[model samples]
Target: MTAAAPSATMRLIEASTMISQGAEAKIYRARLHPPAASSPSDPSAPDGCVLLKHRFAKQYRHPTLDGALTRARVAGEARALVRCLRAGVRVPGVRMVDAAAGVLGIEWVDGASVRALLGGGAEGEVEVEERDDGEEEEGEEEAHEDGAEVALREYGLTPDQVMEMIGAELAKMHRADVVHGDLTTSNMMLRRPSAAQPAAELVLIDFGLAYISTLPEDKAVDLYVLERAFASTHPQSEPLFAGVLNAYAKGMGKDWTPVSRRLDDVRLRGRKRSMVG
Candidate 1:
């Protein structure tokens, strides 16, 4: 299926700031409409700020078929977000959807991705201002420039605390029976603490690959996916991941044992596949 570019979409793109792009979609930091006054406006006022994910239309398929599939996928993501929200899982609220144009707009999260916070490279981060030519780019090394401890202190967090948040949040999401098919630190954000909201909250983003599943196997795989992501993204991350699992287990209550056993099995399969490849 294919979608003819809408003029409105083009205008939105022109006014919005593109933050990242993937094979499936392009993300933008955009406001639904212009600020009431260009001069100055209330910071607390709702400006319809959103993180827009625009799914590119497939050109290989018939227009009718592609349009239907695109709409279904967009709707699926929105439904998943709603499910997570109802289950008390922290996630961006769906703001608007234009299935015909394959666009899904969600609440703008004001913070940094967990990966960036944990010293993972921020390849597509949106910065508030451009640094001067002499400034160094912030990355894994930059995050730890002073010291890991000092870094965490700046954010009022410890490595273990972040891990616990990750694990508990995943369990909450799983309890709601929503499988985040692609679980990674980059997909999780740490909302900056403010005077109004003193506690930093973790918010899950990107439901493009999320789906509903009651199966324990799916949940286990979700954990396994995150495990690998942690291993590859952070140094000496095994202990951190273990902490996450512990928190996850506690959050799961009676639902932990089965998923834990399944996770072990998934890990074994992953090892075997790696050796085979």
Candidate 2:
């Protein structure tokens, strides 16, 4: 007998434009049609475009094991997103889910990544500078800071305000027990401000490695991860991160005391605990 063919969702993913590929999954920008009742006037109406995250099969694992893991991860991510939404966290809404095929569809966000907005170069774009004497350039250090200010102005916010938004959003997520395993500027997005929504909202994305946890250590580690990301990606961002922490404390309220103290301890010991036997 011949082997079974791929499912419709898999076929759709195959036809979609592959936007980004990582070790765990491949992201695609695709248009999906809504249910018949969604738009009666246009029965064949498209459900608008979406960002699809397709978790491909892992070759190393057994077929059954791989399928189980993929489905579990897809389900976990979808659950986390829904939980965040209900908790008033600003994140992309889920549009579709195909756990069997390991495909998850989310609303397409129209703005640039936070990394790009901060002038750290566009998503996936890297710049390598070659110096003859292998020495530092004098004014190069100030270039990103200046560009970031201009970018923030376009969004009607200052660097400090942006940091505050980030902190608040993360605190909201943690309060809901949703731990974003990977926290980086590249994972955050600033949706373009509009008349209806005057403020440029900060959206957290890429929850492939997220889970539910209420531990203070977990929450502190989440903040620490973001702090390190800022230190590495954005130069002269110490004050900006401080602003984020301040806002985070306010959002966390009474719970902030423990997490704040844990954060200091995390910084001292680093991300990983010493594995001394």
Candidate 3:
């Protein structure tokens, strides 16, 4: 007796486990079985499952506008992932794309997020003790260091080494003209080394906000956003970030000078350039 044909995306979604959700999309983990072979003796079976990101419909916006935005964003993200892969950047591979339905399936990464490896917990869900003005308390650096020790042991990486990896990877992406609009630790992952591969690789994910640009200002703002994230989340991350910049400088080669200068200027003025005189 033969079985019915697989429903591809629908079947994958039905069997998938909802992993996470954000304002823009929901992610799931599931097996993306290949289309049935035309020949019985074919030898092209895929090994395993993939991660699916579905940009579900938004009811807040007008129906036509919502549909257009979802389709465009899905296609844009898929294109960015393909561009990064071709540029030798370690990002998840594109497995499937359904822009009409706003679904993208990509290679599943089997590891923890960089934020979790840095002792920030999954999704960096640390409780921020608030001051009178709602700013986080300033004395949590000591506690952060203590937690980081255990986290470092689990991942077998020192704080300096992690910073260096982050910097080098970002430089490569910038060289490829891919600007990751969101450069948070949460968007990066350290893939676990497999039997076939000895060394763990750092991968950048979540390209929904990514775009192609060679502008130094855009690159500077990318680094600035990361710098601010570290300041807020990791407490006393100056030396670590400095190590990142050192590796980044070497990776960026001659292009490092302008980006470094622009980064400084950006720091002084904050992320936004004032429109009014």
Candidate 4:
């Protein structure tokens, strides 16, 4: 849906469009233009557009608990994304936060999800027959960094490359003491730097389920979740996953050893700790 025209106070005036509606929140796309030199400056100096995640009040939840949880999660997500950005991990920058309102505005990314970039799962490819028969296919094929369907048919990137990007980006996030609780392929996006640029980079998003923890166990479990996601979604993902771990190992430096050992143990036992009364 379109937002009304901008008022004096709204940075995102005319910038709001719904992205998704979930049990907890509704996401909106907010267009944030760089302030004209004459406009009043914000400390953040927000330029370009951003994705605004507004956690709506859940009538079903107990008001007190809902308010507390919603506020906590909004803050947690903003904090994690900010930490990842500071760590040089490719994450959307937080431009504004209204924790009480459960609103978090982040850098608007231009790309496709890693899942769509990789041709996997029930999500099918684009119809090739739709193309004009006389028109030749466009340009040299490059690796699809955006997601599955486009990545496979259009970008021509192999599964291994996607895995490597996943590994490296996760490692970077972990090194910053951030743990992405829901480490799924769908949560990550591949960002093309520019239309003319050949290179593309991985961007971690959806921090609503994330938190900060420096513990090796937490980090290992994070990797384990991603590994499980890869194995279940893509066939013959062992070597591809190994490549991710390798890149992660190199990027993690001294912190890699402990987390690596814990990851092996987690693989043997599974994601959760055994419960004993």
Best by TM-score: 2
Model 2 — which ten-residue stretch has the worst lDDT?
38-47
- Report the number of the highest-lDDT candidate: 2
Instruction: Give the per-residue lDDT digits (tens) of candidate 1, residues 1-277.
Output: 7986657866786677787888788888888866776524643333557888988877888989988988999999999999999999999998888877888889988887888777666754432233686453566344453344565665688878888998889999999999999999899988877776788888998888999998889999999998898777664345578899999999999999899889999999999999999
Over 3-104, each residue of candidate 2 has an lDDT whose tens digit, in order, gives: 899888988887788988989999998878544455444322234668999999999999999999999999999999999999999999999999999999
User: Would you give me the overall lDDT of model 1?
Assistant: 0.82
Find the number of clashing residue pairs for candidate 2.
Answer: 0
Which 10-residue window in model 1 sums to the lowest lDDT?
140-149
Model 4 worst lDDT run, 10 consecutive residues: 139-148
* Residue 129, model 4, lDDT: 25
Compose the digit string of candidate 4's lDDT tens values, residues 159-257.
677667777898889988899998877788877555554677778899888888989999999998888877655533345678888889988999999
Per-model TM-score versus the true fold: 0.84, 0.87, 0.84, 0.74
- lDDT winner between 2 and 3, please give it: 2
- Model 4 clash pairs are 50-108, 116-147, 116-148, 117-147, 117-148, 118-147, 118-148, 119-148, 142-155
Residue lDDT tens for model 3, 76-170: 99999998888888899999998877899999887778777776666647644667986656767667666766666655677788888998999
Q: What is the lDDT of residue 79 in candidate 2?
A: 100
Off by over 4 Å in 3: 1-7, 34-47, 127-143, 271-277
